[model samples]
Target: MGIKRLRYWLSSLTGQVIMVALFALVLIQLVGIQIYRMEREATLGLVNSRFTLQRLVSVTRLLNQSPPALHDEILRASRSETLHLRLETSQPLPDERSARFEHIVRSKLDYPEPLAIHISAEHNPRRVHRPPWMHPHHRPPHHRHPPRPDIRLQGGIELADGRWLNFTSLSDREVPGWSAKAVLSFILLAALLTGLMIWLLQRTTRPLKELAQQAERLGRGDKAEPIAETGPREIRDTLTAFNRMQNRLDRFVSDRTRMLAAISHDLRTPITTLQLRCEFLPDGEDKQKIQQGLKRMEQMLNATLQFAREDGLSEPIRNLDLPSLLQSLCDDLQDNGHDVTLCEPAAVIYRGRPSALRRALQNLLDNGVKYGGKVQVRLATTPEQVQIQIRDFGPGIPEAQQEEVFKPFTRLDSARNLEDGSIGLGLAIARTLIHQHGGTLLLGNHPQGGLLVRITLPH
Candidate 1:
């Protein structure tokens, strides 16, 4: 049961659309995270020998040589790596001296040749003397390792020269939270748009649902009202079509009913005249046969009129005691020399059209007495529903033919009496009446070798 319900939900168009939207949202978020991480990784760079430590030493030494008054300015400028100053000595060096200087440079920077310097000591007479051990290879006591940069802003990467360079930066200083304000705003917008779409979809589809319900009701012999016209152009047109069809169907039924009623009405007068005419005939076999034929025709005309009238009855409902009604029917039959008994617990009140219900019950009782010698009627009620059963003691109708016997113009061979038999509309009319009261009439075999007709009514 649970799995069946789940399958039905999954099959619905609304559920499928929602599932697709959620999948797309999750996919977009995942892609965003991957791109963000890739951008972060691209911004971090590795160190190289050409960007040697000697360049940093030269720049720092130059900054230190500046005048005391300009010291703060130089330091501040150096922090942003904007400074670009040249270092010039007082005299030219000999070839041997330059070569020795290059070797010392290699030993100090721990790399070969190329380097870049940024500050100049032009405004100061003396450069800050570096201790003999203060070479590029000689790491400073305060610098345990190269400084890491501000990750949230622009991050800095360390060069082999011991200089740090700022890399890619984010435009915003602070990242926004996807919390109450943001979420609420998104939800409000989505809700407004979704509501509008839902309304439009329902407008287009509601008539279709109503039309389906109408078809079902009609199939069950119910005269449901036609669908109303309201919605989009397509839906409105469809509803209009359905209303036209219903109107045509109603007219057809009306015309047929009127024709049947007219034919039966016209024939009744002649049948009455013929019946009277036969009564005065000589007392012989030919007269008796003619009388029987006229009687049968009258019975058919009467049954047709009754059926036509039944279709026009307004189903005005009322509350009545079902047990008492069944007992009354059984008692009446018994008093008329029929073997009918009533089995009831107590008064069981139910809501239904009383007159129609009585007619249905009467038809069943009549059938019981006509076929079976003994009739047993029983009533039982539960909190939720009520059931009345009429059992007859005789050869029951065949199981295969039980459903067939309830159709209009149907009669069992055994029930047909040459002397006096009905036109075979009783069961059909009973079924129609029972259905109007929102109940069911079922024919089944009785356990005690007879037929049982059960009527069930819901509370």
Candidate 2:
């Protein structure tokens, strides 16, 4: 579960930017720390060498000036926790190259060639003492302590009488490193920069989010409102194109609807005149046949006019209680002696054109009762959408002809009887209305031997 959540977080744009920024900051900090350590070590080494050289020179001068009997006392008095001085008898110095401190002492000596200086490890026969900076876990056991601190400088300086003055000095202090406050400050800076970067990225991507939402609304057949042309140039250009396309689509639909309405209105006058003429030509077989043809023509024209007028785009949209609407429809059908049932779980409200939706649903229920004997309506709701299922226990449509039934003026021979005054435009009109409300109407065969119509509407 933890890994799944991590993957989800990483998939977002904000997460990706934050991760990259943090990684870059960490890498930079690591490099900076390594460089700082190297420079600090070099600077401390130089300063320590200089200090050791000055201390050695001062102590040597003091010992040479003091009497032979008081030299030991002076050395003992000079010994401290951070510095150690000792007087040794004349001895042969080991052959070894002088370290950093030895060079400083050599330059200070008056007779450089005659003076013998050898650097050796600081060894203590007593208990080992660890530095305060060394962690407990990192410290070696009593047997295997690692080398730390500076080496001991052991050498002899010749006096005027040829008596050799031997001395040893132990360095006890180390250079200071970075403090805790410095590390904390670095981390705080990195966090602040990362937060600033996230804010800027969110601001840049805000327009893209709005664009995506607008496109989705257009796809769902809802009216697309114009968005403000703000942000970068690329975002503004894209939004401008989308607005232009939306305007063109709206104009095209309006023009086509108006043209169809005009044509239907112009044909209605001739249709009425022909119907009146048929009334005057009476009482023969040929006359009756002509009258029947005229009547069918008139019905077709009227159905077309009605279809063109119910173009839901022109209807006013508002919020209405859907369950109540379905229950009321069922009640009306039941009063008319039709077997209709409504299964509603609760009151559900939806935003759409109520009158247009009512006409569409009424057509579906009427079809169920006309062809099939009984109709069952069920309403289901979810967080995102609502579903309505209308089922009928009639001879279902053939698999090949189910889709064809939705085309205007098309009917299945095995399903709906053409003699029942169904111009075959019912399904098409219902589907058109549902689509205008950003919904879908689908027809399928139920598993229990009937036709099922499912309507889905997004909230």
Candidate 3:
């Protein structure tokens, strides 16, 4: 279940867009941090190099002018916590010169002769200790060391007197901390950008959402309102096509209904003529059979005409009390000596064609009372829909014949009597009306013993 839910969320357009935006933001932030680090390092290196070169020139000039005894005191004055300088009598000359430092120093100096120089760097030990107030459990299992600083400039230049003047100088420039205001500003900018992207996505997709809803209404046999051709060119084109399709469908349905009505009307004249001719015939078994055939034909023509007339979309929809409607229907049937009962009646207001819906429910209740011998009407409502179940106590329909029974003029031999005018159009008309209301009419056998007709309507 968890995996299925996660897949569903990931598949949604909103989730995909958010994920992409988040990834892009992370990538941008990473690149920005890297560029900032590189710039900061370059600036720090340039400043430190200049400071070291100046100190080196000063130390060289001081040694050349002062006596040997004063050299020790002068070197001591230069030493401090951040910088350490000393003069050594015997020290090994470094194998290589610091090319960058040499270039900078030579550019500034105007010495008469070439000066021998060697520069090298030393690594400092990292301080690793927990704060005094920190609990032992909170401390890391393994100590994490801070990053090592850049190498210190430790080398000496040849003095004019040939007395070795070795000195070490270290700069105390630390990397600057990130400003709180800068971090806050970046966070705000990211939030604003994300919101803007979301808004744009919604705007771009709004037409598609509307189109989907309109298509759903069309599928449910409901009248769909024409959507405005707005948004991008592609979206506008799509809406135009949808509107055309809706018009075509409406025209087709209207033409087909009119054709059926015309055919029925045209046939009624001949059927009436045949009935009039049968009245003049002599009374016999053959004549009786002819009359019955004519009567059946007339019944079929009338059913077709009625079906075409109630095309489902012609009815205007309005909010009505569904429970009250069912209760009233059950009361009417009970007055006619039908064993019909309504259970747990509660107020349920729903939007639909009240007259059409009443006819559909009436058909189901009549079927239940006729075939099942007794009718139990139950109404249930949820936040999204209303459901009506008409249950019967008679022998339930066989699974194989349940669907067939809903077709017009289809009758199960044991369940329906042809002589009783059971033309088998009840379930068909009921289902048609229910579907027109954007609802479902389903048939099922009750677990205990009878047939159940379940109707669900969107609220």
Q: Give the winner by TM-score.
A: 3
- For residues 1-459, what per-residue lDDT tens digits would candidate 1 score against the true structure? 999888876676554665566566557766776776556544421121112224444544554455546644653444322112222232222222223334443465454334331211111122222322122344434746423322222222223434433222111112234679757866676666567656665666677888877865554345767788887788789889888987887788778888989999789888888888888989999998998888877877878777876652455556887877887888898889999988645568887777888899998999888888798888888877788888998788888889999887787876434125667898999998877666799999987788999998777
| Candidate 1: stretches off by over 4 Å | 1-113, 116-226, 269-281, 317-352, 373-389, 413-419, 435-440, 455-459
Q: Regarding TM-score, does 2 or 3 come out ahead? A: 3
lDDT of every model, 2 decimals: 0.63, 0.74, 0.76
Number of the candidate with higher TM-score, 1 or 2: 2
Q: What is the TM-score of each candidate against the true structure?
A: 0.59, 0.73, 0.84
Total clashes in model 1, counting residue pairs 3 or more apart in sequence or in different chains: 2
lDDT rank order: 3, 2, 1
Q: Is candidate 2 or candidate 3 better by lDDT?
A: 3
Give candidate 3's error at residue 246 in angstroms: 0.8
Q: Which candidate is the best by lDDT?
A: 3
* Residue 202 accuracy (lDDT) in model 1: 67
Question: How far off is residue 376 in model 3, in Å?
Answer: 1.8
Pull out the clashing pairs in model 2.
Answer: none
User: Which residue pairs in model 3 clash with each other?
Assistant: none
Q: 59-121, model 2: which lDDT tens digit per residue?
A: 677777778888767766655433445554555564554565456666776645765665533
* TM-score of candidate 3 on Cα atoms, chains taken together: 0.84
